[model samples]
Target: MSGPAVRFDAVGLKLGGVEILRDVNLSVAGGAIHCLIGPNGGGKTSLVRCLLGQMPHTGNIEVDWGENRTIGYVPQFLDFDKALPVTVSDFMAMVCQKRRPAFLGLNKSNRRLSDAALDRVGLNGKRKSKLGSLSGGERQRVLFAQALIPSPALLVLDEPMTSMDEVGAAVFVNIIRELAADGV
Candidate 1:
């Protein structure tokens, strides 16, 4: 299957009787970066949420490549449970079309793929560590690894750089560029 260029035609969204966005049309061609900048409550996140179908919206979203495309997402903020028990390896394993981790049943190939994804996100060394032990930046990278681990054709990140430092943002930007370049 080929990757699709995302298109939004006259999309409109409303929530709790409040009209958040309307007539928002955007055509996102594949293999390019599209930036959305606006004020607080200016519907930037609303627009993104509409594209993600997290909320119902009017109009259309067309993928020009004409294939069943998979989407991976990371939210703007992740206040995870302090008692969460998953490790980095466990998170990466979720992207392999399994929907859930296999616990102790993964084969050699799956393990290799999970390893690669962790390495790509700079979290290889933390694979066996608890997710709660990671620093904020490291935790963000782990989230990135999980989202990108599947090598999905399209990645949608809402405020992906929200909590990162300058150096962390630079590193993540490079990773995003590389993923886009590799057609992930």
Candidate 2:
């Protein structure tokens, strides 16, 4: 919490007889903003996956959380059935709800939090809209909002601005700065 949040030591990755990443050494300080920039298929996503434990790699990877550490992740892609009847509010409730079953309905406090998160991402009016009806950019914002619920000590965003408009991107950047300032 007080030092580096993550450290990579001579990290290397390979898949299907191909080298995806090699000799990668980096440190992400706690309460800081770090960006991974590279061309497509350049292993950016792979590195994220490795950090999240979604993929296997070789090397020493360490994550340091001083106390009360939790991780929140927003993935680069989301796949859902087009025919699902989920609403934006319902989706958020599922993500934010802790003790209550989703079908039991969102309590007043949870609803307020969900609404605020949606408003932060410029999706305030879409809370009751059908998830399947949203465009790709809207869906991405929804994902970002979901990640904000029950804030974590470490936030991992993989191509988080994908499909976002200028306004949404600006809001996201501001929120990231605020979170960092709060030592998240």
Candidate 3:
């Protein structure tokens, strides 16, 4: 693999006077999947948040993103959460803005990009589908496509398989592997 797109050196995190991580050093290449498994409360989310420059930490995190690179995040499944009245297109717009804060709104270029992302995730035909109306698999795929629309260099997914059926999980895994392999 090429050099790491994300790197941490002697990284550590402490929150509420409690240590979350310590003496940790790791690197994630541009195109690779590094599964992290441990007992509960092992700071998995904390670590990823730190890497995303979200948490307060005591170390260095270096990101070597290529041109037009950014971070794509596939949030945990929320089918059980409050329903949404908006369409899938609206969610895609939100995801685009999340990736590119400078993006004012859903302009023409952004729409085109989002549409292509939907196509990649097999949700192109469902752009107008209500968020609450989509099946579990479709919803997951929507979020996946949204994250990838901006073509982020690193994709951060936290337990992406949650709330997904076997077929959905399999499809989601394929998408992830493809992204990693394509060096996005």
On lDDT, the leading prediction is 2
Clashing pairs in 3: none
Q: What is the TM-score of each candidate against the true structure?
A: 0.85, 0.89, 0.81
Residue-wise C-alpha lDDT for candidate 2, range 46-72, written one tens digit per residue? 999999888899997899877656778
Residue-wise C-alpha lDDT for candidate 3, range 34-126, written one tens digit per residue: 777877899888888888778989989888866655788776675444365678887777766656543244677888998898888777899
- Runs in model 1 deviating more than 4 A are 1-3, 66-68, 97-102
Give the Å error, residue 101, model 2.
3.3
Worst 10 residues of 3 by lDDT: 96-105
Q: What is the Å distance of residue 30 in model 1 from its true position?
A: 1.4
User: What's the residue-level lDDT of 156 in candidate 2?
Assistant: 91
Task: List ranges where model 2 is wrong by over 4 Å.
Answer: 1-4
